[model samples]
Target: MKLVEITLDYPYNGGETFCKQELEIAEKYFDEILLISMSGHIGEGNIRYVPPNAKLINARKARYEASVYLKSFFQLLRIRTIREIVFAKKKLRTKESMPQILKEIFIYYYYANLLKRVFEKEVIEDDDILYSYWMAAPAYYLSIKGKKALKVSRTHRFDCFIEECYQPFRREIIEGLDCIISISEAGKKSIEARLIPFTSCLSEKIKVSRLGIMKKSSATDFGGKSNKYFTILTCSNIHIVKRLDLMIKALEKINIPVNWIHIGDGELGEQIRTQAKVLDSNKYVKYTFKGVLTQQQIYDFYERNHIDLFVNCSDSEGVPVSVMEAISFGIPVIARDVGGNSEIVSSENGILLDKNITPKVLMEAIRSILLLDDDKYINLRKNAVRKYRECFMASENYSNFFEMLISMAKEK
Candidate 1:
């Protein structure tokens, strides 16, 4: 079966990256797969560019986003002074740029329209399943075209936690889709609460299907080698919701010899550095902002580095791929036990935290895990890899997931 996977960008953004890896894994199930992403950089490979469009300004921002993701992936570079940089760049040369709000709206609409038109023209010629990576505006448009074998929309995120969310608006288009998959149970719940009002007022269905990661990367996955003392590493964008500051606070409170390293860059990185400085660079605490190391380099770091634990402090998540990767290299996680986290760990694999959790509470949890003896540590490591094989092993999970879609397509 030919499956046309739709996404907002190329295999760059987190969701699209998931789709990209899914396609790689699903190849055995689907005869041919075509990708339709507006942030499709047909030119520089990964540099996201809005394919040709009537909305030039929106296209420009797409280019800028593609460039930023490339920088994020390559050198761990941050887009400091976005406006200043845009004015200076060769593309957006004028200082008098459109208001940020208007530009974003335009880009979203432009991408949706461009995708709708492109798919309408292309799918007429190909008979296949339509598996959308995320329930963005583009997904809504693509599902309506002609003769689709199976139309599946996967929910990786819901902007619905806040007022004036767009999730319901997006779902209005796919309430009757063949099958809709949610990344996390939490995400599926949100879809129910938010979309009930508009369910096509239709009699259709959706399902919650999880995505997995490569069992092993061509790049070695990182597992902190230092088991002499517990070392926890958080690999995520250093954003506010990540709550890295609280991790620092927990470290300051815990008497155990501990060090934490944050692997990605974002808006909150400098604040993290300053907080570390305030702790007198605590004797037991060492911090490294390793920027964005390549996947292989990260794996090598895992093999050589002395890390004992992986921690996810994100306030929200869609089953972090990074957590799976850490475990793939035999590192156990002490995540905030939220979202699909439990799907990753339990008493058998690793530890979880409270939702209204405090620093002192977390400090105690880490302390309990770290205090485990050599035998316990070895058992946890063994269990971590077992879970990876039993559950994640992306190569097979991907094939199974797409095969489900492919079979549905055949039935349709």
Candidate 2:
């Protein structure tokens, strides 16, 4: 069977390097694959890791044709756009960016037209699987493409949450797809909860499939090597949702000498840095922002540095891969309790703060973790490692997932 995998951005960007490992595992199941980049960089400076028997198509380069848009516009309207508009007016309207909403809708229309041309020009086997990384716009477009191939989509944070969508998933689109795999159990529940009111039949098609990461050979011990000062780390795009400012404020509350390191940069990079300086005015904390680094560099940093505890203050997440990566290094986390975080963090491995995580709450969590004795700290480290092996092992999870996908694609 063949697989056509669509991603927003994967190998070409440093952010979603895990998709490369996913593609690597997927290569074993399918003879030939089509790797389509919905919005990945294709310039000379960018590097892409593609599978052996796969073709790469950077759809970002494709220009919009008026005829394609017109055809797709009508098709989209038929797929519950009118109903969605009504729902949007009544209630359950999305708070996401207007430009982002427009972009998502346009991308689906663009891709639907693009895929039609590709299918017409090429040979697509009946047993092939059309899988979109996210179950938002792409899945809907793929569903209406009128292809015999199996259509599957995986739901993540933004795509799965109705509150995050300007226009939530259409009932027809969910009914149309062969299967929908949510990255977290929480995400699956959210999808089913929304779909059940409209049509209970679509609920059966949604399934929970957790994300995984490659395990590491060696991991850092709990409490780090030097107990004199705590070294806290966070790896995420510095955005408002991430609430990095909270992490900085928490550090300020901790009188203990500490080292704070941030691995990624984003919209709030400068603002975060400015706030970090203001919060750490007493010099009790040493701040180091590594901007953005490749996954290997991040892992290497973990290997070289003595990181005490990983912290994630995000308002929402879909079982963050960064937390998994931290777990791979035997680092316990202190994360805000929201959107699949409880699946990863617990009292045994780490602390989970309430949704309304004030600086006091964060400070207390950090302080309590820091106060752990050797025996307790070691146990926490062991639990982190055990959790990774039990849930987030890449080889086992992805291999099993692909097998299931192939079986579904082959189903008559």
Candidate 3:
């Protein structure tokens, strides 16, 4: 059977990870695979960028520039490429800034033509299933209008709503599909909360699969003189949503001599550093701000470092990749019992903070996890590895997962 997976094809984002991991799994089962894309204006290769894979179609005359995003309201409204060229040329002749309208118009045509190519030219005419890796206008169009293949839409639910200005074409397109995959049960609830209000009935097309990471990640050494203090690895943005502050405050409250390394960069970077300096800059709560690294770097760090526990502070997630990576490495997790976090981590494998995910509670939980007897740590690690192998292998779970899609394709 023929199958194709399409994403905006941006590099190094969660959506990119989903696209790559799921595509790799699909490649093993399907005969034909097509991944189409145009250059997007995000961090080129930093945050989540990947070396080009599958099929790449960078349509820009040159690399994307900063001016592209500053389109005018009028241009944004009546966005058309023909009008954009005229607008840009007129602005240049007058030595004035191009209105935002021209830029918006350019992007509209950019995406439209890009999708036109993928739908009309690149995709195999008789593909059995056309999978949308991320929910967006392009995917919505293929799902709703493409007559050649069974359309499948997977909602990451990051912002799958019709906001004040941004139209949610993606949700509209997934209305009637062979499958509407949800990354987490929380994501499913978000769909029900946002979409169910308008409609009375929903379909079983909605299915949940926790995100996964490369199973065997290389470790990074925590480069310290001695491994005396318990090393905890906290991976997430240092933002209010991630609650890095809570982790820092909890460290202050705790009397134990522990050290934890932070594994991401975000708005809370400076604030968390200040908090750490104020609390105690000693080895007791050693906080390292390893800016966003490559996916392999992240794994290498985990492999080399003595990361005793994987702690998560985010308030929201589907099945977050950090937790999956931790489980895959047998590091276990200690996270707020919120969102799909509770679904991935269990009492047997890790400590689940009650609703009170405060500094005091977080401190106590860390102390407890670190203080676990030798047998307890071994058991937790053993059980977590077992869970990863049994329940979360990409090759196995996704085979059954895509098999369901194939079954649905037959019905359609």
Candidate 4:
């Protein structure tokens, strides 16, 4: 049977590198794999290599026009929409205004209908697996239209947590899917807590499937550094949630020499750069912005250079793969304790700061690491590598993921 995977933008954009290892494992299990991208298109640059058995479909070509919006507006009158509105009013103590809720519902139906039309043309079979990379519109559509196929979706921070994004018809989506896979135990718990108002049995379908990375050929040497400056690396889309500005502010307060290297770029890139200019006056704080790099390129950077610390000050996460990559190379992390960050990072491998981490608090965490004796520092590096092997090793995680998929397909 075939396996159809739905993604936002994989094999086209720099984002979703986490799917690369999982796809490699998936290629071995499914006879035919269809990679349908909801937002990916050709000539966007940095197109990734797809597996031999998989076919890439650029669904973005089917642009949503005024007609789609009109259709969505009409869908607001449907019984399902009304039921969801009633359910939300009774169960959820949402902070969103009525207009905001209605707007989100319109957008939801618009995308769900769009995705339904996109998949309608596909050659799906009864025993095939319809997997959504995110528990968003693709999963919502699949849950409605997946006929005898096994409908499954993986939830990340933004898609899984209501606080992160507006999830329309959350209950119905959970009810429709055969299984919902979360990237972290924290995410699984969150989903269960949200669904408690509906029914406890829905929680049975949820599972904690941690994302993993392939082990590097060699771990970074703790003492092998050409430069004397303490190197700090942060890799993520320069978004408001990532809090790059806070990092810059924190580095500004530190007295010791530091070389901060940021990987990846986003809408806030220019803004963050302007904010970082303040650090230029401080000779002790030197920062570099390495624009968007492919996953291999990031790993190559790790191999060639010695990174003293990796820091993630993000407001939320679903066990960031960037942190996993850093720890794989024995780089100790200093991340805010949010979402799955606590599961991967701790006092052993690195410092897990509180969620309400300010610039001053972050600076103190950095100083704490800088103050560690040679033996203590070396132990932290060793622990970082050990953590990567035990929890984030790709071979064990992805193999088990596909085996579960294979079992579900067979059972169906």
The 10-residue segment with the lowest total lDDT in model 1: 51-60
Off by over 4 Å in 2: 60-80, 91-104, 200-202, 220-225
Per residue, candidate 3 scores C-alpha lDDT tens digits across 97-138 of 345434434455445454664556554654478777666545
- Count of clashing pairs, candidate 3: 20
Which portions of model 3 miss their true places by more than 4 Å? 11-15, 38-53, 58-114, 123-126, 146-148, 160-171, 217-227, 281-283, 354-356
Per-model root-mean-square deviation over C-alphas:
10.0, 2.5, 8.0, 2.0
Which of candidates 1 and 4 reaches a greater TM-score?
A: 4
Candidate 4 CA-lDDT value: 0.85
| TM-score, one value per model | 0.78, 0.92, 0.77, 0.94
lDDT of each: 0.62, 0.78, 0.62, 0.85
Error of 2 at 142 (Å): 1.5
Model 1, stretches more than 4 Å misplaced? 12-15, 40-108, 123-126, 159-165, 197-204, 217-228
Give a tens-digit lDDT track for model 1, residues 1-412: 4667676656444335455466556555645556665554435434332222211111223454554444334321224234323432333233333454234334444555566546555534334777667776555555554454666778775432212232223443455467767776766665566554445633236566777776344433333335555678888878887888878888886676777777887777787877767556567766677876655566777777767888887777767888888778777788886667778877776787776788888788787777777677767777888888888776777777776776776677
Better of 2 and 3 by lDDT: 2
- What is the model-wide C-alpha lDDT for candidate 3? 0.62
Model 2: per-residue lDDT, tens digit, 1-412? 8899887766566555668788889998889999877663556366667999998876655444677677766665554545555555455555655456555566666676666665576677789898988776667778777788888898888777777555445565678788889888888898788655675465778887777987455665554435667888999998999999888878887787778889999998998988888655756778899998877788888888878889999998999999999988888899988999999999888998898978988988888887788788878888998899899989998998898888887774
Error of 3 at 307 (Å): 1.8
Model 4 over residues 1-412: C-alpha lDDT tens digits?
Answer: 8989988888876668888888888888888999988763556676686889999886655455677779989998899877777776667756677778788788778777767777778888889999999888788888788489899999998777777666777776788888999999989999888864585355679998888998558656666332568999999999999999889989988998889999999999999999999998998988899999877899899998889889999998999999999999998999998999999999998899999978999999998897688788889999999999899989899999989987988897
> Considering every candidate listed, which one attains the maximal TM-score?
4
